[model samples]
Target: METTPTEKKSIKNFFAKLGPGLVTGASDDDPSGIATYSQAGAQFGVKLLWTALLTYPLMVSIQEMCARIGLVTNHGLTGIIKRNYSKPVLYIIVLVSYPSITLNIGADIAGMGAVGNLLLPGIPSFIFSLGFTALLMFGIIFFNYNKIAAILKWLCICLFSYIIIPFLSKTNWGAVLQATIIPSFEISKAYFMALVGILGTTISPYLFFWQTSMEVEEVRQKKLIVDKAVIHGMQTDVKGGMLLTNIVFFFIILTSGTVLFNAGIHNIDTVEEAAKALQPLAGNMAYALFSIGVIGTGLLAIPVLAGASSYMMAEVFDWEEGLDKKFHEAKGFYITIIISLIIGLLIQFLGISPVQALLWSAVLYGITAPVMIAIILHICNNKKIMGTYTNNRISNVLGFATLLLMLAAAIALIWFLLK
Candidate 1:
């Protein structure tokens, strides 16, 4: 009954392989992403399933570029941008990202609190959200990077609940397959907006900074700063994480498509609504599983959202930045973290629907994503910055294509908003 050395080695190797990429992918399906996917399924049903299939490769490719830049270069994405780009451009970048990240933080807090209330019915969401905000600040400000990573790795497991939900419900796999392989939707403003949201939540701009910075952190952890080691195993790691992310996205869509849409419930504007709707279709277990999953994933995601913003600001101002450092060591860095959380919490108190805010946060990301993606492509391909790490033909093709795709989405979103 005792485990052999080979088994233990395999277990150790399996865990060793999952690092930044895994955390990045897991963080992608945060509360906002969940709300977006839920809305897509509840409103459009199987028609939008093709998006998950399409974005899988795009997500992996774009993230790998960011990861490569971080691994090869000595600075984070914004650090590179600040050094090379104009100050006006830098200000513009921060201004654009400001609303998206901040709104997302608020919406995510509502989401985490909403799920917490579901699990602990005695607590009101307002109180729960405030408590959660305090908990997140304490953990990040006091805990070391290693401890935070360890905790996030465990929370990542909750996302698989979505994968389980679809199997519990009756699924028309034939229809699901057809929709996934072949896109079937008209060209309308609504459709364009939905497309934008999907892309925004999937290949988001915040992810670019977080992944890049984390890769640089990985290098620092291994004492490879002087060696400037060529990263060998990260592609596999990133790809595996992205694959899991897309799989979660796909199933969440499928679950709603099968359960909510089929039941003539087409609108899901809140986490509570979605949870309530899931009960009869997927049963009580699925409902409870989903309720807990969002809370856990929210815990994991909130920091990433705050960290991405903090990292960007720290790099822009040239302040000492890193989750590795304590509050005293990086006062501005941790203060930014506290302020971000406080602002997000305040937004939740305003008379706005949390789920709607979550959805709109994705829309903002849709608008901002193209601008960042273009810069990322430029930064990753520049020979001066990346040196031999410059993107190859495949990476370039996919990277540029991702930029073009997001650009088109941004343009479409603008044209519709104007009308």
Candidate 2:
């Protein structure tokens, strides 16, 4: 089992080149994602497991396009959209998307506070929420890109608890394998809603903006000039990152589906509920594992939700922005991040159900997805911006399909809501 020296060097070289992809993949497992996977397994069993697998390629394709655009053009999505598209178009899209995103961040902060309370029963949820929000804001404002990325990377490692817990549980591997490979469905409105929720959670628009912006940051971090060859490397990095993300997602569903569903626990309103339900079947280790995953993913995801919204706002308004820049250089950008975190913290005081807030946020994301996808496609295909790196025939085919699928999901979500 021991590796040769040559093999060891190769492995080290591989890891040395891996950066942005790992971060992107890790962020995908945010607190909202943990809630979605937990709810799916608790309610529908493993029936929706295939969705995780199916979503991986779609996510990779969309994110790779975003990374490519950022690396090739040396601009974020909003900057490109503002320059190429009409002001009216930019105004309408940013107006609607920005507020919804900030609202979702608030909901995530509330959810984090609720989950934190479970971990530390003596702490008040509101205080913990507010304190954590301030800490995150301060970290982003004061820390350089390397420090921020390092902190986020460690937070991401916390998600691996879910992977370890599944093995400790008495999993029905035969059934889990079946569910993962085979597609299943029901005709009820609730089923449709759940489907919408899963799609929204996985193919999030904020992630697209964040991943693309991070690529630009990565370029600056390495002090690399923007060029065709470098852009291609960025695409490879994106694919590698998303691949890791999908692998983690698949296992999350596998663990929850096997442990929670098979036990006949059909409803879970929070991560704590899901964790406790696994105790009788999967033991104390399972509970600890689930709790740890929730805390870790929440920390990793909250900043992303806040930061992405900040980047979009700054870019659209032409404010200087980037984690690499000093505080004075990006004052508006840092201030916007703080304001978003504050708004998110305020939601905890409203006494709203975190689960309900998460559900509604997912629905809102589902509704907005189509419009964002349309804009992303237009921007990526524009030769004026992308130059020779514009999306080719295959990219267009995949991108178009992704857009159509999201549109259908959005329409279906609306229909279910109306019914």
Candidate 3:
């Protein structure tokens, strides 16, 4: 068989467009995200589906801004902050964020272990957590950026299980369509909390760091990287990725809303519970498929958590960083990844529930999401950095709107806690 180079190049070019945005978007549906979205559907049904619609454009604009920062300046988010901002400001960001990141890594690992326990009887979640921890660490430490990115891009397919589970259930598409198009408000503690969780999981602060740093990595990989191809060209891919992100977001809520919520099973206390709830309504095959998603997304996300954390520290401390860098060349960077995972694993041993760990991790990130959004807007708009590449009128407007939405969520979260 004779194959044309042009045909091969076209195929190569198609895959080339996928990078940080696709990986970051897929990782958004990590174990915690699944639980949160499941809980949202079980507890409120289609009530909070609008949050997906609301946050989609907001997240797209936000991530595109991050992608630009990395491409134009050739520095990670923290590196840009380190150079422009005070040391006190930089350290404060890291100190506050590091624990949350560690706890989340730990929670995700435990959740992955729980999925293991579900699939393999007689193996406890705690034991599975330990094994998953080692396995994830091995991937991050051993694999280069190209290898890691390639693996994650494929793993993105696992999120389709969440998408498929909905189809298996009985959905009231009329109500679903109405709820999605015409927003409804619920004035209650649970509703606000769920809203907060949804926003936190979607427009995550760590995603900004991961997005910018990976773009920097992309630049470093191809020294002659075209900003047009890699930066501005990212919007099409970024939009596609984020739309997929929200579509999965929509379906998870739809699945649980149709199945569990309708069955009057509103109290989905954990990922395992969510999986179990699916069976009675959607069948064993649905349950099995859901559990597989849990494992798939967990494996896909844990590295992003570890890598984003490591990239933050390495950039801030001026230590060598990047999954592209070999282990010896980036010892401190790699060690930080190990340290985060270890500390994350220790949280499980400390008698903390993985479900609580996951939610609390989201809340912690939710608190700071607005602040990070503000900083990102400032960075991208500064002509000193972006030059003509600065965010245009449209970007600035949407970016600030996202900031305002996040600020309101943070404030509402506080009001709920205090009351």
Evaluate all candidate structures by whole-model CA lDDT and list the values in order: 0.84, 0.78, 0.85
Using lDDT as the measure, the top candidate is: 3
lDDT of 3: 0.85
Q: Which pairs clash (backbone N, Cα, C closer than 3 Å) in model 2? A: 106-344
Give a tens-digit lDDT track for model 2, residues 1-419. 99999999978866655566667777777766777777777778778888877887788778888888778778888888888889987787677676667767776676667667777889987776787787887888888999988888777678678778778967777877888899999988867777787788778888877887888888778888877677667766677677767767777777777788787887776666776677678887777777777767767777787778878999987899999888899989988888888777776567656666676777678767788888888888888888888888888888888899999998988788778
Clashes of 1: 0
Please provide, for model 3 over 133-218, each residue's C-alpha lDDT reduced to its tens digit, 9 standing for 90 to 100: 88888988888888988999999998898888777767778999999998888889999888988888898888888988888887
Off by over 4 Å in 1: 1-11, 225-230
- lDDT of candidate model 1 versus the reference: 0.84
Question: For this target, which candidate reaches the highest TM-score against the unseen true structure?
Answer: 3
Model 3, TM vs. native: 0.95
Q: How does each model score on TM-score?
A: 0.94, 0.95, 0.95
RMSD list, candidates in order: 2.2, 1.8, 2.5
